[model samples]
Every structure is written in structure tokens, then in C-alpha cells.
Target: MNLALLFGEDFVSAEQAVLTGRRLAHLKSVLKVAEGSVVPVGLVNGDIGTGHVLQLTDTQATLQVELPEPPPSPLPLTMVLAMPRPKMFRRVLQTCATLGVKDIWLINSYKVEKSFWQTPWLSEENLRENMVLGLEQARDTLMPRVHIRKLFKPFVEDELPALLKNTHALVAHPGTGTPCPVHINAPATLCIGPEGGFIPYEVEKLVEAGCEAVHLGRRILRVETAVPVLVSRLFDACS
Candidate 1:
């Protein structure tokens, strides 16, 4: 973990916080921090700063926290994604977070397996955990918002229009004529499909909802690979 992400529960007082579990293990094994050492720390949905270790032990560590710097600016992008395979879902979610995608929509697609939604990684706790891993990797603290929509048609017809408002909307399809735009660096909504890509009817629905069908060349990238590539291509300042 690059930054120790502190939740509200980690705080004992305004300026003091405690670390345990994975973070404590990281401190002991990875950082090898002493009681007097300072480590990079950030509060969830708050700011980035440093924590001076006041006490250290095998189980926990206490630190004096000071947060004055704002986290990196979130990407003005809304990601509408087809639910990926259970095995890849966690990694995709983490990638989205690491790319600074604050708005994420995990919607159903024709190729998406129904069982994909049953994965434990979709649970609130697991989602937060994976996103935390991503945030800590990026040294970012702002938590991303994930919206789940299991019904594809209803989501496209009812919700997606408003979601795409005032944004450059595009859907990444494999064989589409339009290449995915680069360095737009403005508000955008991007839709990506499952392994085999979205069916024609689903693509039509998304297109009807304001997304322009676009492609990332002839290569068919996996959902996990495509997410970061497309995000970086569209935005200039992810870091």
C-alpha cells in the first residue's frame, strides 16, 4: 500500500489515529517503520498527508495525523461497464478506481453471465476493500461511487440518458468505425462490454441513449485491459 487509508473509525481524536490489520502488517513487514518514523497517510474521501508514528507494536500502531493536501482531482468520466467475469471483476473495479473514475455503472449486457453478479466481490465490503487497494495504490483518498444496474434495457432507456448529460458519451465496441478519441480531457461517459462485446441490439440501445459507438483499433481487449487503456486515452491527467 502506498498510502495508509484511514477511515473514520481509525481516528481516536482529531489528530490521532490507529492502524491495524493489513495496514499494520504493511507497516511492520513492508515499511519496517519505527515508533518515531513518519509514513504517508490519507483519510478516506479526505486529504493526503503524513502520520508520525507515536507508538508501534505487533498488533497496532498509533500515529499523530495531519492532513493538509487535497487528493488528486477525480476524472470527469462516468464508466458504464458490462459486468465482467467473477474472476476479473475485482481487478477491473480496482483499475477503475486507480484511474480516478469517480462514477462507475456496472450494468448487464447480453454476453454477461448472470452468475457474474453473484460474485462476493460485488458485496459492499468487498467492493470497498478492492477500491481501497486501488486508492492506496494511487495515493488517492476520494472514494468512487459504484452504481449497479442488472437490467440492461431499463438502465439504458431510463437512467443512462441523464447520466450522459453534458458529457461526451462513447461506447467502446471492437469493430466500430470511429476510433476512441484521445485527450478530450473533459467530461465523458464511456461504455464497455463483456468478453464477446455487446450485441447489436444492446449497442443500438446505448447509442440511442446518446453514446457514440467507438473502437480501440482492431484489437479486442479484455474488459480489464480495455478499461485503463480507454480511460488514459480519453483523459490527459489521470495522475
Candidate 2:
């Protein structure tokens, strides 16, 4: 964990917090910290800062926290994606958070299995857990929001158009005519399909909804691989 993400429950006072469970283990074993040691820390959906160890024990570690700086700027992109395989979903969610993607939509597609949505990772607790892991890895405090849309047509026809308003919208399909735009660095909404790519009908619907279909050359990447590649191409994070 690059940052110790503290929640409201972790705090004893305005400037103090306690670490336990995985974070406590990491402190004792991985970081090998002691009383008086300092570590990077951040409050969930708050700010990034430092925590000075005040007390340590097997059960918990108490810290004096100082939160003065804001977290990393979020990418100005809304990701609409087909639900990936259960095994890959958690990692993909985490990857999205780490990459500064604040808005994510998991939508259905022709190739997406009905069973994919049954995964426990979609639970509110699990979702927060994975997102927290991602935030910790990125040393970012702002939490990402995930929206689920199991019905394809209703969402595309009913909701997607307004979402695309005033933003460059694109769908990533390998054989499409236009290449995915590079470093546009502006607000955008990107639609990516399932494992075998979107059926022609789905692509057409997305296109009709204002997304210009685009490509990332000949490579057929999995959903997990495609997301980061497409995001990086769309914006320069360093800027």
C-alpha cells in the first residue's frame, strides 16, 4: 500500500487515526515502523498527507495525521464498459481507480454472459474494498463511482445521449475506421465492449447515440488491457 487510507471510523479525533488489520500488518511487517515513525496517509474522499506514528501495538497503530493537500486530479473521462469476466472484474475496477477514472459504467453487451453480473465483487462492500485498494496504490483519496446498467438498449437510448453532451464520445472497436484520438485532454465518454467485441447492432446503437467508433490498430486486447491503453491515449496524465 503506497498510502494508508483512513476512513471516518479510523479517526479518534480531528487529527488522530488508528490503523488495524491489513494496514497494521503492513506497518509492522512490510514497513517495519515503530512509534515516532512517519508514513504517507490519506483520508478517504478527503486529502493526501502524512501520519506520524504516536503509539503501536499488536492490535492497532495510532497516528497523528496532517491533511493539508488535495489528492490527484481525476481524469475527465466517463468509461462505459461491458461487464468483464468475474475473475478479471476486481482487478479492472482497481486499475480504473488507480488511473484516476472517477466515473465508470458497467453496461451489458451481446457477448457478456448473464452470469458475469452475479459476481460478489459487484457487492457494495466488495466494490468499496477494491476501490480502497486502488486508491491506496495510487496514493489518491478521491473515491471513484461505479454505475451498473444491465439493460443495453434502454441505457444507450435513454441515458447515454445526455452523458455524451458537449464531450467527445468514442467507442473502441478494433476494425473501426478512425484511430483512437491521442492526448485530447478534454472531457470524453468512451464505450468499450465485451470479450468478443460488441455485436454489430450494439456498436450501431452506440454510434447512433453519438459515439464515433474508433480503433487501437489491429491488436485484440482483453477488456483489462484495453482500458488503460485507451485512457492513456486519450489524455496525458502528467499534464
Candidate 3:
């Protein structure tokens, strides 16, 4: 539940804040929060607090709350992803949010299905919803900024450099190399390909644009799968 939405007069303590919105119902019905319970409380863009249930009425609930420790910072990576199918896009967006990507670019690719572009899930509202789900799941409030690029070369040759001002740029491709290097101390820009992966020409253009082409071994993973794998593997390597 969003702490900003909690309302009432007697909610003086962290335990007295009552929730009456959809979240309250979810907790009472699904989570089975009982009277005198203390649950996780958080501000919309602030630290997590404790919600102590002082009273529970059919229409309202109260708690005592305070925001203490701050939420963790976002991962220092900018993800450049080729637009996948609509369903795939939803998953990818959420995953990117949970992984704390600094930014996301939904770029066009040579292998991108023309019909996939027509999916309504690409609409702003739908995309935002997926990102919210991802943030909530990860206990993160900040949303990653997202971009769209329908053209390939123009984006790589023109816009990418500025976007990646101080970031180390890398593109995820399949083959052999030292494997995507472990997370470095600095921020990074990672480019992932379309379903069948980036064509050689597309890869070459990106390489010329200052992004190093890196591999994840021989196994070609789906776009949705490659993302988290790369994020964790690279970050863990550096950690």
C-alpha cells in the first residue's frame, strides 16, 4: 500500500495507521493480517516504516509508522534492448526495473517482428504498470527512465554516445570471449539483441559506436532471459 494514501485522525503511532484501500483488503483477505499486527510501511518515495494496526474496521485500518533506513540505490547500468514481442516487452521492462537499470532503450532491430510492434502492451500506460509491478516486487520506488528508438543506425551512431557520456558501453552477443566481464566499479551501458540476435552489420555499427561486443557463451537465450542473467553475472563478478 502507498503510505501517502493512508488517512485518518487517530493514526498517531506506527501501529495505529489503518489501511482501507485495495491494499488493506489484500492484506486482510490474502495476507491475513490480524488486529495489533505490525506490517511493513513505506512512503511513496521514502524509507520503509512499520505499520502497527491499532484498530481494524470493515472500511478502515490504522497503524503507527515512520520511515527509517533509506531504500537501496539503483544498479549502475543502462540497458539498450531491441524491442521484443509485446509479451516479452512487459517482462523485460519489469525485470529491468527490479534490476535497477539506470535507463532502458527499446531500440528497433533487423530481426524484430513487424507485427510485434503493433502490440498494445507497448502503450505508455501498460508499460508503466509493468514497471510498477517490478518496483513493488523489488521494494524499490524509483522507476527507471525508458526510451524508444524505431531506427537502428541513427540511434547508435548519433544519440548513443551522448546518452553514454561516462558509461562503459557493452553489447551482449553470442560467441566466445572472456564472457561478459564482471561488474566494474563504474557505470556501464549494455545492448541486448532481438529474438534471433543482432545481425552482423548491426553489431558492427554498435561496435563502431564505442560499445564493445561481448558474448554469453554458445547458448542463445531469449531476450527476457538474457537480461537478468547478464545483470547478475556481471554485477556479481565485480562484487
Candidate 4:
């Protein structure tokens, strides 16, 4: 896992415990780590450490370990996106994690098909599967929290402010006041609309909510691609 690599430790060990989805497959088909092998280890949110391969058998693999330091500071931005199509959602989640975004708020929108909401991909197990894949890709141990808001206005006008108290906020809209800033300096919460895009009323409410309307370009970018592209661009600006 990249988080382990990023932290320089294995995620599981003796005394304390952790669960791994692919441990069996990893031991068998993936790493083929043998007994007595020293694998770097760390806890998801705790500390980076080392896990000694105590035993490796078909039943299971156990690790003897040592804990290390905590994980690094994460990206300062939180993304607010209109829930996209099923296939694109997986990519978006993975991209966000790969880029160190740990807080994602996926909400419903007018352009979002009603049928899309019922997808099995939103199930807890499926959501975690995608999130873990993203974490594994990033080599980051910290898992970003994902939230869903079905009703748009209430989430925007009510709960959003408290959630965004300390962060700068921006909403990506086409034909906005100014092109999206090349890079943003402070911590921010960015909201991006669904493919067909946010209607005038939605943009107005976001503006009233204190979000600066920023456009990435003259043309619109699909949500899945736009989310990562915008986040990466902002990461560079802030870094």
C-alpha cells in the first residue's frame, strides 16, 4: 500500500490488529512474501511501522511489528461534486485519493439521472473498495471521508457553511466572472457540477453561499476529468 510506503511501514502486526482484503491473494499471487520476510507496515490512521512475516500459509499470514510516526499532512482542499455516472465515479474517487484529497462530498443535481442514484456502487462495501484502491494507489494510509447530500439547497445553504467555516470556497461554472485562478493559495472547498452543468439558479445560490464562480476554460470539462484536473492545478498553485 502506498500509505505504508509513504509512512514507511506495514499496516498490520502482532499485539494490535487490522484487516486486509487482499492479504491472502497478496501472499499467494501478489508479493509472495514468505515467512521471516520483513515487510514495511503501518496503521491506516495511526503510525508507520514494520511487520515481520511471522508465518505465511494458505490459511493466513501474520506479521510481527513495530510502529512508527504518524502520516503526513493531507491536501487542504475538499471537493464538492455532483454525483457523476457509475464508471466515471470510480475514476474520480481514485484520482482524488491519488492526488491526496481525503474529503469528498458527492451530491445530487438536476442533470444527474435519477436512475443513477440507485447504483450498487454507492454501497458501503463498494465505496470502500474504490476508496481503498485510491489509497493503495496514493501510498497514503489516511482514508478520506466521503459524504452524500441528496437535497441540494439545504445542504448548500444550511450545513455547508459550518462544514466550510475555515476554508475558502469556489464553484466551477462555465462563463463565470473570471477564469479559474491558475493556482489557489489558501485551503478551499471546490464544487463542480454534473456533466450537463449547474443551472443559473444553482450558480446563484452558490454565489450567495460565498463561493466564487470560477471557470476553468471557455469550454466545459466532464466532471470526472475536471475534478482531478482542477484539483491538480490547484495543488500546484497552493504548493
TM-score of 2: 0.98
Residues 16-93 of candidate 4 have per-residue lDDT tens digits of: 333244754654566667777666655565566566667766766667667666555589988898888888888888
Q: Model 2 residue 200 lDDT?
A: 97
> Residue 177 CA error for candidate 1 (Å)?
0.8
Q: Best candidate, lDDT-wise?
A: 2
Q: Residues 1-239, candidate 3, lDDT per residue (tens digit)?
A: 32223333435554445466666786688667777777665554456656777668888766667667565577888899999888888888888987777589989999998887788887888877677667666766666788888989899999998877788788998973747887674688899999888999998898888888889888899989999988887675322
Give the Cα error of residue 126 in candidate 3, in Å: 2.0
| Local distance difference test values of all predictions, in order | 0.94, 0.94, 0.76, 0.74
Per residue, candidate 1 scores C-alpha lDDT tens digits across 118-175 of 9999999999999999999999999999999999999999999999999999999989
Model 2: residue 76 alpha-carbon error in angstroms: 0.4
In order of appearance, the predictions have TM-scores of 0.98, 0.98, 0.83, 0.85
Which consecutive 10 residues in model 1 have the weakest lDDT in total?
230-239
RMSD of 3: 4.0
Cα misplacement distance, residue 150 of candidate 2 (Å): 0.7
Please estimate how well model 3 matches the true structure, expressed as its whole-model Cα lDDT. 0.76
Q: Residue 29 in model 4: shift from native, Å? A: 2.2
